[model samples]
Target: MIVADGLEKTFWHRPNAKGVLGSFRALFSGVGSAKKAVESVSFAIEEGEFVGYLGPNGAGKSTTIKMLVGILHPSAGSVEVAGMSPQLQRREVAKKIGVVFGQRTQLWWDLPVRDSFEILQAMYQVDEKQYALAMERYDDLLELGSFINTPVRKLSLGQRMRADLAAALLHDPAILFLDEPTIGLDVVAKERIRGFLKEINRVERKTILLTTHDMDDIAELCQRIIVINHGKLVMDGSLSALREQIGLPTTCTVQFASTPQIQQIRGIERIETNGMQVQVFYDKRTISTPVILDEISKWGDPLDITLAEPEIEELIRRIY
Candidate 1:
């Protein structure tokens, strides 16, 4: 559904200066350095595939998305969204894609939510039957009826998000670009959006590219991930493939009734002791939990046990 080859974007930054005249001079001279925000990035996404595009700040993720949506033209290489260049045929591409940014809303703030949908219906030239059908389906799936008449600016963050999602999908685009869609949302709100996204991708077969800082979002919603760092693609594969490649280090925190002698185990590594608890790091690929628990039982009576996987940030740091 999407293809990018050697895609790149560069920006010329204004020069820094001490005084007002110096600033004016710098601006006129265009003396600032040129920076490559996105460099030679290449990837292909198939229809109905949910891929997570992940990276830290200044990692070219937004740049790539903008290029894909025709908000910004690439400095080099080519991009084809559903077989047409977004730069050359933006209107056509826009008709095939829906974009949502967490920090921005496409809806008119002063308009009632219902009015916004009506406006979109005219803008997209949606027929009456299709518009009614879209509203019916969205009301059923997104619960839009609860605040359909409320002004968009008056809705809660979660409600606003749902309304925006509904607005984006009103045209029934073939692809969806969600940039930090779940950021700053409560757990319940996050889950609601996640469930909606999963259903849309599964039943509607919409190709989704989700960019998020929350690892849980990626883990739960995306089947595959494309990790980028320093303007380069570091990893791209199935979630399971990444876990296997990274060893999915599982940390077991076992609290005993008393501190036990720290002993070497066959499959555990990086074993450490802290007061009443013993922390053991082991690769799930090499050790089963039952065996590890059995070894712990041999040393002392356990008070509590918990296991955790490495955080997404730690995983990215490891890759870069």
Candidate 2:
């Protein structure tokens, strides 16, 4: 549903200086530096796909998102949303897309949350029947009725976020661009948003491109990932394939009654003994889980065991 080819963005700004005159002199002298926030990035996201656009700070993630949403024009490439060029046809593109930036709300600041929804409904020119259905669906999914009468500015962060989500979806857009949608939310609030996104993608066939620092968001919500660093594409594939490309080790933490002299096993990347616990990192592709369990049984009587996959950050860091 989204296509980007050789997409890039560059910002020209004067270098920092001690004073205004120094900055002015640098600017007038044509000495400003051009920083390429995104360079030659290319990727395609299909309909109903949830893709994570992941990277560290200053890694061009937001720049790429802005370009895709038509908030910023690209410097050297093209992007199309649902077969329409977002830059050339932003109004139509906006009609098909919904956006949520976690740090900001699109809702009117001083209006009641219900008023904001009404305003959006009118602005979108939604049919009365369709609007009613949308409101009913979102009120059930997002619990908007609880805070509908509250002012947007008076709602808590989580409440405001949920209200914003409802507002965004009131028009029944088919695509969503979520930039850190769970930022600053508590565990419960984050999970609520995650579940909502997953359901929206699965049941409604919505295409979502999410940019988040929280690895949990990527792990739980995204089916595929596109990682970038320093304005370049690093990885783009399934979550498992990305992890395998990075060679992330699967960990098994086993607790025994006592430490044992566990002989080294092939395919075991590393092993550590902490009193009554044995921590093992292994290559799952090389050795099966049964093999690891058997080896651990032989080492000592395992009282407890837990397995874990590598964190998303670990896989993203591989590009560095």
- Winner by TM-score: 2
lDDT tens digits by residue: candidate 1, 31-101 = 77889988888999999999999988999999999999999999999999999999999889989999999
TM-score of each: 0.88, 0.93
| TM-score computed on alpha carbons, candidate 2 | 0.93
Score candidate 2 by lDDT: 0.90
Q: Write the per-residue lDDT of candidate 2 for residues 217-254, one digit (tens) a residue.
A: 99899999898999999889998998788778899999
Q: Give Cα-based local distance difference scores for all models.
A: 0.90, 0.90
The regions of model 2 sitting more than 4 angstroms off are: 16-29, 257-261
Clashes of each: 0, 0
